[model samples]
Target: METNTQILSTEDLRSQEYFLNMGPQHPATHGVLRLLLTMDGEIVKNIEPDLGYIHRGIEKMVEYDTYRQIIHVTDRLDYLSSHMNNEAVALAIEKALEVEVSDRIKVIRTMMDELTRIASHLLWWGVMGMDIGALTTFMYAFRDREMINEIMEKTTGARLTMSYNIPGGVMFDLHPDFVKDVKAFIPHMRKVLPEYDRLLTGNIIFQRRMKGVGYLSAEDAISHGASGPVARGSGVRCDIRKKAPYSAYDRVEFDEIIETGGDNLARYQVRMREMYESLNILEQLVDNIPEGPYQMPMRTLIKLPKGEFYQRVETARGEFGVFIVSDGKKNPYRVKFRSPGFSNLNALIQAGRGVKLADLVAIMSTFDFVIPDIDR
Candidate 1:
């Protein structure tokens, strides 16, 4: 028997690059998002995020929705940051109408914002650990997160996408037990937060996986318009709460968490530290909640003056802005949302280059994307 012998060129024997689809249904993606990745074996050479898997035409839909009704639509954009999303649209409408809400409204909105931030961070922390193989962190995180959800449910009558915030102020006043429950949650979170650090932040294996992975420099972060923890991780001072204070954030004193490491670890550290700051914010405001009408009185048919209006708020993930063009009608002529997830995902494409496939998951966990926010 004669066997056929053939020689192959060096180029022909080299490994070939190929494309891989990561999501639209993957657990690590956290939502309905698909990432088109170009890979050379285990290394990710390029990443192009394919979004809109969950698009609901929220922006265009708002054009037909009354100003009051639009608040609920914003809730679905970044469901985790629902309160902040509500506040953004409410604030823009208030700005357009030139209606200054009561001090009570401002303080309550601010407190609720912090609560939402803590809840969002808690879920992210839990999911991040699970993505990296630590399953226990999920239970620990949800345990604390349930406390906040309970508080919100009591006040807003809805847990997740609570459209408690309306254009003028809020749908209703805080629950009678709202302050007490929040105050109780503060200390509990303070005690348990350190446990989180011990469980995941200090884990050597976690650190080795995340510390130097997915590096995004400050310049690149700003160029890509990354905000919230993603930009802060790279030492960018882009906190809208600090730069432009709205709702009672100007009254609170808390350090803006910033980490200069410019890596997945740095991003993780920023959010971890932010949880403490959220607690600090809640501590400062829970007891000092002002007394007055939770919502301001407005015409039954609310119509913004014909012009352009814009408002920005610091949500759990980053800066969330709402821009509205009104035609002096109850509904807006056009509306747009400046969602943080989209910008942070843009930054991810830069940070993810050159990282291994496994490391990409950790980096994405650090980014903490909410798919609807990006797709919207």
Candidate 2:
């Protein structure tokens, strides 16, 4: 025994360990993200991210595109729910240009943003459950996701890439069938979610796998810049939409979901409760999208006025900020996006340490990463 201990010293553990690359094309990765991990059997000894492979210099791409052209680019960043990305960019541009949008447009954007929130959470629930070993819930969650996607496709040219949001307003008015479709979705969504509870939320196997797994304390969660469900799970009540109301959010009322556990289950609960809260916000604003022209018609190009414009919006991931420096020209002198996922990913080194290889997937799913959002 003494001889074996001498042979397998700390130096041996460090030297003989293997480094594994889990993504960039791994099947479980929701997008183009890659996780470089150092492992020892079931435990992850260390993990580091090597980003920029997916970078399209989206920030650079926006400089030449007219403000309208920028909307299309936002679609590809976090394509799971493009409406949220579109809202972040549109709100930023509107604040920068000092443009006044109609009340109807504000209501429309808020409702759409909340819908995006629900859709995004649904997809996360599905993917996270799959990671932790519950396959049926993933299918059930996607069934509900398809409903929201149909709503998106009807209004926008594509379901996954919504160029629906524009600078001063949305690209198209609420469709004639909008109200009826929304009303039908209300009960349909409510009914569909309980099965998720029966299949995954309350299931013993899922609880065993997720509950108390991947714990991240509040201090570390904030210090590392965690956001969205991950931050909220760690007892942070920082929702940008509530703290900094934009569009018609101030006009609507909704609860912020929070959990003290800071575990995989806590993150799951935040997202699950958020879906219900989103439903409440949508119920209030869906029927009241007033009559108005959709996109702000501008034959002229960007022509941003001098000085700078800075704005933040609560995305499905968290607070997304856009900073624009304009020289009173059609092009921005500089454009910088303080993307939410970029900071959230920083916390992974802490949250992921000493976790099981399988639980690593759940930890990452909680981050809800969108690679292009970070790469951009």
Candidate 3:
């Protein structure tokens, strides 16, 4: 028998690059984010994020709303960090008015802010696990997060978007059980958080997926304006609470978490350690809540002076800044929010470059952004 051989052409051997759309309807996105991906085989070559699916013109809406009503608009920007968002706007307004909130209000706000941070991180932890195929972590994360929701509902009358912070101070006094519940949570979280390490952090599979993936450096993080865990993962010290304290954060002593690895694992570890620091903050203030009115008596209408005012707060995801140009009007002349998600999202393309398509999900999860914050 005669032997026959076949030769392949260059075109037959070449791998064709293709484009893929990840969302506007994908679970991995966590929102209506649309990512246009260019891929060569399994490796990602480019990422273009198409935003505005959920944009409600929050900044424009704030211009028509009063100072007191502005906080509510900010609520929908990052529902998970609503309390901190509200505080940012309230602080800006208060600064414009030159009014001092009571120490009691400050203490309660600080505690509530920490609670919000922990709650947001809980969701991030669970979703991150789910993104990487560890389903059990989803259940365990929500178990502890529910406790914080209950605690928040009791005080703010809403679990996610509290709308609790107002121009002068908070909406209402802390629930009678606020201190007791927070104290209880501190112990419970300390116990529950360690289980997270065992379930996912130490798992060989998870370690392999996260350890060297989605690497970003301190210089890139700074140039891209990343914040919160995204920046800290790259050894960038950008925690607003530590760098520039607002809303009783100056009174608390806590370590700023930083990781030099600049990988997915580094980001994960940053958030994990942050939860403990939040616990530390709660411990220091739980028993020390001062006795005073939660809100100051305000005139029916709030009129800020004709000047620009800015306030920044450390939210669960990153720095949430509110800037207002008053023009001595009932409503702000111009309203702008410096949301962390937008800046963090800008870095995704850089980080996702050359990473596997599957690993992109893990990379984004580690960034831990709330999409509406960017959409706004």
* Candidate 1 regions with alpha-carbon error over 4 angstroms: 1-13
Off by over 4 Å in 2: 1-15, 296-299
How far off is residue 359 in model 3, in Å? 0.1
Better of 2 and 3 by TM-score: 3
lDDT of 3 by residue, 284-367 (tens): 998888888889988879999899989999999888898899888798899989999999998888899999989999999999
Over the stretch 1-376, how does candidate 2's per-residue lDDT look in tens digits? 4798898787766655689998888766666778899998778999898888789988887787666677788788777667877887787778777788888888888888888888888888888877667787778888888888888778775778878887878777777777777888888888877867877788888788778888889999889887888899999988988898888889888888899999888888888888889888888887777777676655456677788888878888887777888887776777888888888888878888999888888788777887888888
Top-scoring candidate (lDDT): 1
> What's the candidate order when arranged by decreasing lDDT?
1, 3, 2
Question: Which candidate do you rate higher for TM-score, 1 or 2?
Answer: 1
lDDT by residue (49-84, candidate 1, tens digit) is 998899989999889888888888888999998999
Residue 22 error, candidate 2, Å: 1.8
* Candidate 2 deviation (Cα RMSD): 2.8
Per-model lDDT: 0.92, 0.82, 0.91
